[model samples]
Target: MARIIGVDIPNDKRLEISLTYIFGVGRKTALDVCRDLNLDPGMKARDLNEIQVTEIANHLQKNYNVEGELRRTLAQAISRLRDIGCYRGLRHRRSLPVRGQRTRTNARSRKGPKKTVAGKKSVKK
Candidate 1:
């Protein structure tokens, strides 16, 4: 395992794939990092030398907010939205889907399990 930005990336995966283990980094960003650093994207993480690893860590620290930093940044953004009392913020505060999702049904993942209510029984004539 290669520890980058306090996260242990899998050693068996390719460099680009392993780099995505860090939060805020996806395939495109990983490829960009490899390109910028002149590293082989297909190389396994375990094959990296100490100097290469250090270089990678330094580059990420200087150029990107990843791991805990990215999480904190996103949390702050959501908190700001909540403080503003906007519609999206209200949805986030209520733990509902913020993006105009149909809450009438199929939003159980965000709205949580169904809270069924008793329906009125039919009265016989």
Candidate 2:
């Protein structure tokens, strides 16, 4: 369990993939970070030296607004849109798809399970 930038990277994974365990870092960013730090992408996280770990932490802290900061910034942006009553905001408020996906027939993942409506029974006179 190697802790970098306040996040514990999985020791089993390669350094490149393990770094992505930290929030706001993806595959591409992880590769870029390794390249910038002059680290071998295939190296395991547990094999990182103290200086290399420190360099990674410093680079992440200085160059990227990650973890809590990223979450807060995203939340604030969404809140601002909602407060302004924009169409996208309204979609978010209603818990509907915001990217113009057809909701009438699809979007089951977001809409959840459908409820059965009661119907009148036909009487045989």
Candidate 3:
């Protein structure tokens, strides 16, 4: 069970896809890492030797912020926005969509389960 950057990526998966198990690393970044390191992206994580694993860990630690650090950095940015009290910040503060998406009918995912009033009835004119 090889671990990288404190995350246990699946050993049977392809290197490029396994790399995405680390937070903040997407498919493009994983491909770039493979290109930069001259590694075979199609190789499985279990097939990698110790040197290759170490190279990936070192490269990620040196050039990217993942896991806890990335999470903290994002939290700080959102906190800064909230402190500034901007429109987006207000939306964040209210647990509403921050990207100007319609909320009248959709946004149930963000707004959580529906809440209904007791004995509420609709009347037709």
Clashes of each: 0, 0, 0
Off by over 4 Å in 3: 118-125
lDDT tens string, model 3, 1-125?
Answer: 67888999999999999999999999999999999999999999999888988999999989999888999999999999999999988998988999999999999999888887699579989
Lowest lDDT 10-residue stretch of candidate 1: 1-10
Error of 1 at 51 (Å): 1.2
In terms of lDDT, model 1 sits at: 0.92
Which regions of candidate 2 deviate over 4 angstroms? 119-125
lDDT of 1 by residue, 17-102 (tens): 99999998999989998999999999999999988898989888889998888899999999999999999999999999999989
lDDT of 3 at 17: 97
**Looking at candidate 2, what is the lDDT of residue 2?**
82
Model 1 clash pairs? none
TM-score ranking from best candidate downward: 1, 3, 2
Task: List TM-score per model, in order.
Answer: 0.93, 0.88, 0.90
TM-score of 3: 0.90
